[model samples]
Target chain A: MSEVDVVRSSSMADEHVIEQAPQSGTGELDALAAALRDGQPSAVEGIYDEYGGLVYTIALRFLDSPERAEELVQEVFLAMWERRASFDPMRGTLKSWLCTMVRSRALDMLRADRRRPRPAYSLDSADGDRPAMEIPDPSRASDPAAVVETRAVLSALDILPDDQRETIELMYLAGLSHSELSGVLGIPLGTVKGRVRLAFAKLRQHLGIHLEVES
Target chain B: MTTCAEWEEEYLESLAAGSGPSLEVLAHMESCPQCHLLLQKDRQIHDALKEGVRVVPPPAALKSRVLSSIQTSPSAPQLHVMTEGSSPARSSRQLHRGSILIARLAAAAVILLASGISAVNLARSSSVTNAAVALQLPGEPVTYGIVQVHPASGIAYLANASLPAPTPIEGHASEYELWYIPSGGVPIPKGALVEGPDGQWHGAVRYPVQGSGLIAITVEPAPGTMKPTSLPIAAARV
Candidate 1:
């Protein structure tokens, strides 16, 4: 047909080969990370193929909107490319770091959305002066068994009492520190510490995990 | 001795973050198998959660968008220069509005003075006689609409169409400092401008022109003082 169509056809052929290649390995992620650090163009495709689903899922979890989640996924990768130089291998694995980045971006988007006009008072404003309150979404709580199992580690948090669960979700999922949570939840400092401790203990029990306490 | 509960919380946080404890904590855990077992379980849980998390691919168009944005965006040096004067600042009003026009007129004046025959006395009497010649700061690209310098007047203008607005420096009695950084040179302090009660400010500084450079702004304690303790609010090159 035309030159544009020719180029598109060629690219489609190339993508077909890439898609057919094994897509479930960490090797691809490590390679993509290396390529991105080295500023290679092909790394973008590799990264998208490997991590797009995870990033999109995390964004969808927080925003609950496909369009917004898609937009954020793009923004997250764009940021990754822009700030690739700052990626430190020593800090943690690239995947963990990427997860942290995606989560932070999603949380930021959530906060911005809360600031926009809404019919009801935002949970954020209600808990602004208190330690953060975790409002469990019944829908997410009642997810399919597979989805629950997939997120089973998080379910250990469900073993916690409501107050402890509130503290743990605020600290873990929302990335708030103890002091900030105290402010948002309007709880005494001691109470916050107690709840966090109890929550960790319950999580440890539910997950059959043990934590070494340092003297 | 660290309490079981206190250490437990820290351990959980560390595992969630995929980081090991300090050497001291590690040594303790080594001597205490009970704690070591706990740490192992935590790691297992963390790993499982990580595996369960799905990896999402970036959109098909992201690569092109990122590549094009980087290519079309002005170079960093130019951006740095532009941010200096681009703030909706009122203090540098004179400098921002007519910096280029002044530079052109000054260059023309310098040329006429250099040609010499008829206007030596006229040039000598001109107030703009000591105008500084704009020097391109080191490490800056020679890009147009990025930085303009007028040495005679000791003014550097930056084109900052892309820089974001400075966060509102709320409250009373606050000052912001501007620095002119030459290539490979230390930042030279340009004086301070005050922000009004409405958290708005506008002004320019008259510092001894050291070299052609980028402009940087930092918020500081009041009275238009010299040294800057806070991070720069905005920056641009001239």
Candidate 2:
């Protein structure tokens, strides 16, 4: 199921969605998550098949080596399996949670290697050298909803004001917080917040999802 | 009073910060679908952006590596870290014992447990072993340690180590490696032992050690080696 569909099921249509678990991409993700929580071996295979490319792309772009990236992917999934009980789908989508895990562990790995020079780049993030939107991701070909969601995000990001876009990239891609972005971009924290809010608002509009909070 | 608008503004800031919604915002969100939807869309956008990344298919070996890792590497050997269960500190004389006593008494007990007939023949074999064994430096032993073999995994953990921590010397040999040497035969490399906070070695070997050989430890290079280049500093036959 596409991220857009996940968004709609969990947040768009129902006001009571907050009280229930956030559903993602048919009940398959939910089933996978339940299996994972129960420490089933099949869950690892399912999760890897679904999210391995995403994990590898993020790890590869950060670690800059295919071997280390591969190791990191293995580490991430194994860790997720070991600590499956901690995962709560009510908190967020599995993809985003895995993104967070990949980023965190990759950064930890980089930090632990004191002999190596500190990475001045994001640990796990989207491949930035190419316009990812333009590239048709073969992995997501089976799920058109995912494809459209990817395109919409990239397209919305393209239309954002340069300042706002830069702010979001620093915060999201660089894994910087509001204060860090403010410090890096030489702006006040409020300005950092302003740019993110404006960028996200415009993104929501462009992606055809509007909420009262955005106003 | 914090208005819903104020709570909503904080909620947006927290989401953009990549921090999850605060309890205040969550409480607000429980009553506010608008803010909840905002959170959902924000997450969807992030995931979508990540999905847009160029898919670099991982190496085919990664599947085997991940799967075999679970099969081979058990959870950290927390329960096996110490064997003595309060084995008293040995005096210097005991540390210098001229001979190795295999767990013969325990083996005899094991035999006697099978009724009186089996105990006599098994006492002299020196083949029966127990969970705990002493690893000692040969010939008027200096510092000694204990090796606790977890029967299920054959992974050893050190206890009451009077031996100094394995030092990284000459930038080549950094860790203490465990080896299993059969009687009058070549030493098979087990794996490196990691030093715990208490300065004793802690590690598990993936090898299927049968306890039919002498388990020995030698300081070797970091990440360990296939064979030992130096004589073992401490030896114990299980």
Candidate 3:
């Protein structure tokens, strides 16, 4: 069904509630887009809630500076707010869009910084002498209920062949495109797509889950 | 044309979007029980993930900082209704015209270069055997470093004698890729390498910048390839 049809057919109450809720995936993205276009503040909040971590994680990974990461996060949200009108649902989902923006900005910062010589610290050098901070295994659980679910997802991810997992992480977490993935992974584009496909299939089989696509 | 796997992946991608699949994928999905069942399960997993992915509240100061930055920054081009104001529209048109004039001037210069006898001199002067000649990063402070250029072979070597090994991600490996952005072309992929086991890495890439003038290094996933998927960790103009 067309987006207009979905928006119109859904009851007003349902639409309003969906607008307020943090979007999980693309449906929430569409709803968020609609809300932002309508100038709804709640939609902005929903977007932040849904993608703030992803953005923060990416920024932190690249910047290695928490302060810079936080700064980039704020910049991303501002960019999102300003560019809301330009977001076209046809091109890609909001998550992908947000990620693209975050990555571009981060890259710009990185390139800019390369000219300046900054003091460097290597985490690897800290080695045994340093106190070991509890490394949060994103795969490990902290709580029973939510942790179990997270673990299941991680387990499913773990079962994927190495190539597939690596590709998925680079594409989803690291924001690499198919061509970029091929470049980073040193594999053919066809191989990248194949690995992604197999990865998705394995995730589905292991988790017994299917992703829904909005027509 | 869609294989079951493609259809399934597309369907899942759509679900991630919080919607149903494309008409083509969905049609196949409707007729195919395996795919249909897969779709149902995908929805459930997505719903479960919604709850599992906790939304960390943004820092309170971020809003104020963002708003302040926007306010302090130069105003972007403002769209004015024909009835609201004439000044903005006039200014906008003038800006557009100015840009066009500048572009025309640039094009004319290029044409002149192509047609003029000076073009030979230009070509000769521009021809640098080592396109990988190390140049400082534009607008950045220059640090003491050595950029080795093998102009004849089109190879550039970047060595940071005092550079430190990049810190690894908590749970993942980290590596670097080199990029050579040609003077007027797309950035070309060089190769990927990590700092030596002792916190230093020195490497060379087959330079694609035959006539180009820049070299850059970007942190990337291990097993690097031709193009960069991530941002440059360091860059210098060659």
Candidate 4:
């Protein structure tokens, strides 16, 4: 069999928290990658069965459109199937790696279109009044764990200082870099970094989950 | 470049930048556990946040399209396995010795460094400890660590511990495996505890925990066994 992990994360309302837990183990990842590399039957399908939904969800969120997300899903899987030899579970979980690639690719698409994804709800702007993010998938809110984890992250972001909140929203959701964020926000690079540091510090203390949102 | 205290600002700067640790910083982290923990924490936090935004489930057609698309795509060239009839992951493992070596060296260095600090602390405490909470260590507990997990998230951690390897091996990094004892279910081996710079073990389980369960720890050699070879030295009933 491939690999699966036994990592379960709950809200900080209980014990500590885990971010994204991979569904498979290192040996499992290695096996999956190897099988895909050798073009074994159902190997690609097996991967899709595991993480297809996750990949599509991330693509949709970043690309802000279903058509693009669909296209991205196919593109990403094909690339992984072809580049299977390069995947090393030792680097990180297949989940983490896929998430990173999908986000980066979606951002690349956004940049090519010269557009940016609008947040569902603006966490920072003065009015702080904006339309919420629309996820056409009503079934998404069905999973209790996913709901809790999503709420926890949003809640953490909600509590950050407006500046800090905005800093991460743009950096994370938009995949903007420190320098890019500085230019867009018209703030100094040091100031941008300060907000990121303070925001993550709060995230670690408040939710026990966090990281720098970089492109 | 210099002292950890000196590296602190540079570390955070790079961390926030998402540029990853530089060679100098990594070289420094080779000796510092705090920096190492910070790095893992940073990545986990980022991963969690990224995961948060991706809660939407995919449509059925997406999976169908992906499945069918592969039918038309070119297949990977079939190559003979170097060793006859080895497993898939094992075959790949044999193919990329360089990558495996680099990863092993990095992990070993981190765990070795972590054992010096976090493991030492656990050895001294032997009691439940951590910002979250510690798992109970049975059988007189040598260098047992704390465990903190979210109920449904399958997010478990062996916060701090350093114990001698059960194997007769010498001077090698010690790896303790975590197990999910689902109430009365069969013991499932999760993964080996990889020590962060802070000397705590960090990793995830494959799926979510449904009801009551117990997470325990056992020391197993590499490649892994179907079951736990030794009784648990660390355990926490949830």
In the range A10-117, model 1's lDDT, one tens digit per residue, is 111111001122345666667778887886645765666556655654565455444455556656766776787787765555655556777677767768658421
Docking class of 4: incorrect
Docking class of 1: incorrect
Question: For candidate 2, what is the DockQ?
Answer: 0.12
Off by over 4 Å in 2: A1-24, A114-215, B1-52, B73-238
Residue by residue across B103-126, what tens digits does model 1's lDDT show?
Answer: 343333234334332112111121
- Candidate 4 lDDT at A22 equals 46
lDDT of 2: 0.52
lDDT of 4 at A123: 32
Fnat: each model in turn: 0.18, 0.29, 0.10, 0.25
Docking class of predicted structure 3? incorrect
Model 4 clashes, total count: 27
Worst ten-residue run, lDDT, model 1 chain A?
A1-10
All models, RMSD in angstroms: 20.7, 19.7, 21.6, 22.5
Candidate 4 residue-wise lDDT, B1-238, digit = tens: 4555445446655655568768887777666887665665555556556555433445443454454334323443422112322333233333354233333432332343243422212112222223232232344444544443334223444444554434532333234665555544566656565444444444333224455555555554443333454445444444
Candidate order, lDDT descending: 2, 4, 3, 1
lDDT of candidates 1 onward, in order: 0.44, 0.52, 0.48, 0.51
TM-score of chain B of 4: 0.38
